[model samples]
Target: MDALKILIIPGSARDGSFNRRLAEFAARQARAAGQEATLLDLRALNLPLYDADLEALSGVPAGALRLQQAIQASDAVLLVTPEYNGFPTPLVINAFDWLSRIPATQEQPAGLAVTANKPAGLLSASPGAGGALRSMNFLRQYLQMAFAMVVVPQQFALGRAHEAFDATGALQDPRAVQSVETVLQSLARLAQALKTA
Candidate 1:
C-alpha cells in the first residue's frame, strides 16, 4: 500500500526551460492524484557526457550512479522534452545511456524486470508549431529499450511552450493540463497492472 513514486525528467539543460515547467505541472498533477513526484533536472545533474574513456578509467561517475539509483527507486517516470534540431537534447539521451550501463542488476535481474514494473509517461513541447513531435517519437522508442511500461493515449506535445506557463510557473493551457492528468491516470493504472501481472 505504498504511494507511487514518479520521476519528472526535464529534457532541456536551460535554466528556465518551458519543458521543465511542463514537467513540474505533470508532477503536480500526479502528486495531486496521490502519487509521490520528484523532479530530476538535467541541467542540475551536470553529468559528463557518456564517455568510454571515462568509463574505462572510472567505473561510473558518482553522479551517474546516483541517477541510476533514483531510477531504480522510482515507480515511474515522466519525460518532458523540447524539440531540438528536430529531436530531444543529447543530454536526455545521455542520461538514458548512463542509466542503461549500470549492468544487468537484480533490481533489474533482466532488463524488463530490473525496473520493478515501472511505467513512463512522455510529454514534449516546442515554441515552433509542430510541438516537438519528432523528438517525442524518438523518446518513445528509447523508453522501450529501458524496459519501461509506457502509457499511451495521453501522449502530449504541447506547442508554444513559452506561452503555456506563467511567471509563477503555473500551467495555462487547459488541454495540456488535461493531457497531463490523463497520462498520470494511465500511469497509475499501468503500474497497478504491472504489479499484478
Candidate 2:
C-alpha cells in the first residue's frame, strides 16, 4: 500500500506555540511509522474570519481555497490545538468554519474528498496539567460533523506540553512520546482500514 498521507493542522498561531510543536512531533511519528505526514500551519495561511461581507465582495479567498484543496487531498486529518482559557484558539475555529463549507459538487469532486467522510484524529496539548484534553472533545465532535471518522482509541492529552518537546521537536519525556505514539499507531491502522474498507 502507498504510504497513508496524514495532514497535521495546527490550531495555534504563535511561532513558539507548544501546540504547533506537538503537531511537529506527530508528523515525525507518522514518518517514523512508514507513513507520510505534513504540517499545515494556519499562521502561514493568515485567513480572515469567514464572513458574508468578505465573501460577497471578494469571493472565497485563494488561500482558503488552497487549504480546502489540501484537506481534500489528504487521506486523514489530525487537528492539534492549544487550549486558550479552556477552549481552542480563534485561528483553529476559523479553519474549521472555513473548511466546513462544502464546495459545489456535481457528484463529489473526482478522486479528492473535500473534507467529507475522511478519517480524523484529535490531539490537544497545553501548559496546564489537563493537557488541553477538554478541547479535544469539542473538536472531535466538530470534525465528525465535517464527515471525518474521528479515531478515538488512543486520544492524546499532554500536560506541560512546553516541556514535552525539545527545541528540535523531539519528545523529551518518554511517557509523553509513548502516549502520543499510541495514537499515531492507531491512526496509521485506521487510515489503512478506511482506505481499503
Candidate 3:
C-alpha cells in the first residue's frame, strides 16, 4: 500500500496528560507501520474560543488555518481525547469549531474541504476504568456532523490509562498496542480505497 499521511491530535493541553502520551504512542506506532504521522497538540495551537464576531472581523485564526491545512493534507486523522465529566475536552471542541468554519474553496464545499470524506479514528484515555468512553461517543457524533468518514465499531478506549504506559512513554499492555495498530491499519486501508475511488 502507499504510504499514508496520518494526523494525530491530542485533546488535552496538560503538561503530563495521559491523553497526550496516548497520542504520541499512536504516532510512533503509525510510523513503525510505515506511515507518516504528524502529532498536533491543542495547547500549542492556542486557539481562541469559537465566535462569529471574531471570525467576521478577522476570519479564521492563524492557528486554526494551520490546523485546517494539516487536516486537508492528511489521508486520515486519529483523535486521542480525554473525558471531561463524560464529555470531550474543551480544547478538542474549540479546535474543531474553528476548523469547521473554514470557508468553502474551489476544491471543496464549506467545512467539507478539511474533513468531509476523510477517514478518522477515535480513541480516548482516562485514569479511570471507563477509559473516556463517553467522550469518544461525543467525538464520534461531532466528527460525523463535520462530514468525516469515521471508522466505526473498532474504536479504542484505553482504560486505566495512567498505568498503561511505561517510563519511556511506551504502551505497556500488548492488547492496547494491538488495538491501536489494528485501528491504524484499518484507517490506512480505508483511506487508500477512498483516495483511489
Q: How many residue pairs clash (N, CA or C atoms closer than 3 angstroms) in each of the candidate models, in the order given? A: 1, 0, 0
Taking all chains together, each candidate's TM-score versus the true structure is 0.88, 0.90, 0.93
* Candidate 2 structure, TM-score to reference: 0.90
Candidate 2 achieves a global lDDT of 0.77
Local lDDT at 195 for model 3: 82
The parts of candidate 3 lying over 4 Å away from their true place are 105-109
The global C-alpha lDDT for each of the candidates, from Candidate 1 onward, is 0.76, 0.77, 0.86
Ranking by lDDT: 3, 2, 1
- Which is the winner by TM-score between candidate 1 and candidate 2? 2
Write out the backbone clash pairs for model 2: none
Error of 3 at 110 (Å): 3.7
Range of the 10 consecutive residues with the lowest summed lDDT in candidate 1: 108-117
Superposed model 1: Cα runs more than 4 Å off: 104-113, 146-153
> TM-score-based ranking, best first?
3, 2, 1
Tens digits of per-residue lDDT, candidate 1, 1-197, equal: 78888888889867777788888888888888898999987656667898989888886666666677677678777788987788778988887676666666555333244454467788888887778989988877767655555545568888887788877787787777887788788877877666567
lDDT of 2 at 5: 91
Q: Give a tens-digit lDDT track for model 3, residues 1-197.
A: 57889999999878899998999999998999899999987778779999999999998887877788788889999999999999999999888888788788675446556687789998889989999999999889888876665655578999999799999999999999999888888888888888888
Off by over 4 Å in 2: 105-113, 146-149
On lDDT, the candidate that comes out on top is 3
Can you list the residue pairs that collide in candidate 1?
Answer: 108-114
Cα miss at 149, model 1 (Å)?
A: 4.8
